[model samples]
Target: MALGSLGLVAGALLIAASSRWLPGELPSYPPAQNAAEARPAASLAIHDARPGQPARRIAEDLIAPPPLDVAGVERIEPRPPLGELGLASPPQTPMPQDWRETLLYRPVATSSAIFEAMGRRVVISGTIDVDPDRTCAFGDAVWPCGQRARAAFNAWLRGRALKCVLPPDVDRFGVAAPCMLGKQDVGAWLVGNGWAMASPSGIYGKAEAAARGAEMGIFGPPQ
Candidate 1:
């Protein structure tokens, strides 16, 4: 009839262009509201509300208790109470030069003597009672006989050789007072045997007076 009315108007415009391109069934989402603030305000204020029992004795009886009159607090004077201010009694530490000890023999009127070897060396010799005519020529120049001949020539130069003894005294010229053959240095062997002359304050007085004036033993002949 008009091509059946234009084929029913072209099938109703292809069903309205396929219901406007096919996708419409999503509309049911409403379940997520926790905006967070139902009355919450406690950043840190419990001050030991006494729950279990010992939070440091309830935080030191509720918050601050330590300075009860520490009175001026500077103190440092207690060391004096141990020996009470006299502090010098503790300083006697001097005995180690190899620690040999034992020197008290008393009897060298001079003309020295000593010989004790085997270590601790001692060989001093005799006839040094010094008397170039006396005005103090060396009994160690007098007084307790030069302190007992320098304590018996320092106790035979400190022991060994049957404990080197000898201290009976007799020097104004007698001679029995200078003995010690065991510990050597008999006045540097009586000044190397010229009978003795070295004492310019000794240290082997000029090499025992040039080896006793070059062997004239007793200061003779070497001009």
Candidate 2:
């Protein structure tokens, strides 16, 4: 009985020592939240609600009207007299050095006294009244001057291409400003042969006078 009492006392002392030394219970937490409650709050937007059909009428009032001409499309049309574009007319291109060698001259075709050769419409520059109806006063009678001019020009060319200098710029008919055949001036030739007349410009009066004295081509033989 004394041994049993000692054993009980030892067990009671171990329990008390454990209670003093061991850790206390952990602090508690609330139950887990639901998915909906956990979501973030959204920012708010302002809106004014309309009462009725008057709001629809107000929207129609904001609409735009149809254009003046619904059926026609707008177009840009170019009109004549281009001066409005604020640019002077462009100048013609200059002749290249190689062009002189390639005249590929054929006998010129004459309409009235205007002749075309090497793709240029050349008249005796500054000649007046050389066209078909122009008259030559030969002796006492008058005859068509352009006819004699054509024949004379053909005879002079004799089926050989003449090298000519085109103008630095071309004219409306695309004739060179000045042209030549060898040392001879083609325009002067026409005047000297009486095939053309010096213009009021009077640049070739001497040639015209010489032809008149000789009575060649357009200047007919004595009546």
Residue 19 local lDDT, model 2: 84
lDDT of 2 by residue, 64-126 (tens): 674578568678777777543464533434656544432427756474235676566765555
How high is the lDDT of residue 99 in model 1?
36
lDDT on C-alpha atoms for all candidate structures:
0.42, 0.61
List ranges where model 1 is wrong by over 4 Å: 1-43, 49-71, 78-149, 158-223
Candidate 2's TM-score reads 0.45
The CA root-mean-square deviation of candidate 2, after full C-alpha superposition on the true structure, stands at 17.3
For candidate 1, the TM-score is 0.19
Error of 1 at 144 (Å): 5.1
List, residue by residue over 103-195, the lDDT tens digit for candidate 1. Answer: 334332222343323222232322344332322232223323233334444454444332322233212222122233456545554555444
Best by TM-score: 2
